[model samples]
Target: DIRDPARPKRLSAVADSNFSFWHSASFNNDGTKMLFTDEWGGGTQPRCRATDKPEWGADAIFTLTNDQMTFRGYYKLPAPQTSQENCVAHNGSLIPVPGRDIMAQGWYQGGVSVFEFTDPARPREIAYFDRGPIDATKMYVGGSWSAYWYNGYIYSSEIARGLDVFELLPGGLLSQNEIDAAKLVHFNELNVQDQQKLVWPASLVVARAFVDQLERSSGLTTDRISAVRQSLTAAEQASGMARRNALTQLATQLESEAGGSSDGAKVRMLASEVREIANVAR
Candidate 1:
């Protein structure tokens, strides 16, 4: 612990049987979980071919609690690469999507992948970009070395090619509002090695994003979801106290219903965000 930097103290440490080279690691926005990436081949060997085990050269997830960590599971690139590609986990950063633990990371020659580990035991890929190996018949150490999300877009540092940028598009797994909400979280500077706690501003986009999450999870009834959307729309169209009053009313209603909702925590978060929006509305 760095409680006293003059003399550092070690809290706890654990080992996993699957890890080879502990290349890098990162924590979720809330610090409740941590992810460690294994670079088995040092980014110069073919470690992501069909013959490789998924647990090798993969991300090992662990849950953090009371300064203790417990292994949860492992996540690797779902698609196998050819023996010609030098692929292994490298560097990555979190995508600040509220209420979800999403990440965008690079594999040596596996390109870049954006995935979610909200349920640490069952991580899943949400989006990815991959190219054929540099040489189809021979191994090549040319692919993304780092993939990080900054501002509203993802930037990948390609080892062979130059820098690559990406704009996240709305799809079945993620929505436009969620994207917008993520965009609201801006940083003057970012260091992938040092994880930061992401926070979204009190904006209509963020409130709506929370609502969308509730709808996606069926956290609220269809009628209630529809009504909340309608209210938000109306508030957006109104001005002055009219807007504030509408949001305030809706937030109060949400607060009252959250206890009975399936996703009570999310509903309460929605309520709190909406209430904050009402506070700043003009």
Candidate 2:
């Protein structure tokens, strides 16, 4: 089922009765359709241990229309258990490349499988990355959860570990050369807490300072500045340390840009007023 966040509308029940157990779903580039993963065959329950039944661990990706929520078709995973147990595509995302559709799906005990979805209805398996032998029976099994493309690199969130960074390269399907090039960097290994605390506030302050300078140089009206101030006020009202800190940083930037006893004297006065509000919020 899909819901329009902006409108009071819903698109639901696009699949047959056979598609009951599903773990995740992702939208195509144009937002016209979506691809969903079904964990088990029709009647099988979630996290089942019975090997007598056809394992039903095979994963299938289905395409559905966005406007009408109609089922277009499906692409089933090829057979043969690559690992100790059967494969299951759990959580994944679709990357939109011009003239091509790429899908990155999480496979329990199968790692991250990247598929070429040129034909939205029938996707082809292109490449995959398997971390190592994963005991799916174990309580604390590790695997990929979410995959996204940012700054020309594929960033995947590991179950327990932080983020695993990968870069796509030209190579065969299971080529270790490309995998070696795609290194995994641990975000938690860095100063995570400190970095998190500075990111939002730092961004807002820098942006506000840049805009203020540009406005001063161009002799533009204070309308834009006033809008930004109002934004900061709203951010301060948000019930989160990160938001309040960001608003405070914005206030500081306004104060710094507003110099003393000069053409910016009025701006300086407004900055002081904003600072007082920020101080109370903090």
TM-score each candidate.
0.96, 0.46
Q: Over the stretch 131-223, how does candidate 1's per-residue lDDT look in tens digits?
A: 778989776679999999999999999998889999999998899999999998989998877777798888888878888889888999999
Error of 1 at 82 (Å): 0.5
lDDT for each of the candidates? Answer: 0.91, 0.50
Candidate 1 positional error at 244, Å: 1.8
Candidate 1 yields a Cα-based lDDT of: 0.91
lDDT of candidate 2 at residue 218, scale 0 to 100: 43
For model 2, residues 43-123, the per-residue Cα lDDT tens digits are 222232333223244344445544556555565444333334434556665443322356666654455667866455566
Q: Give the TM-score of candidate 1.
A: 0.96
| Residue pairs with clashing backbones, model 2 | none
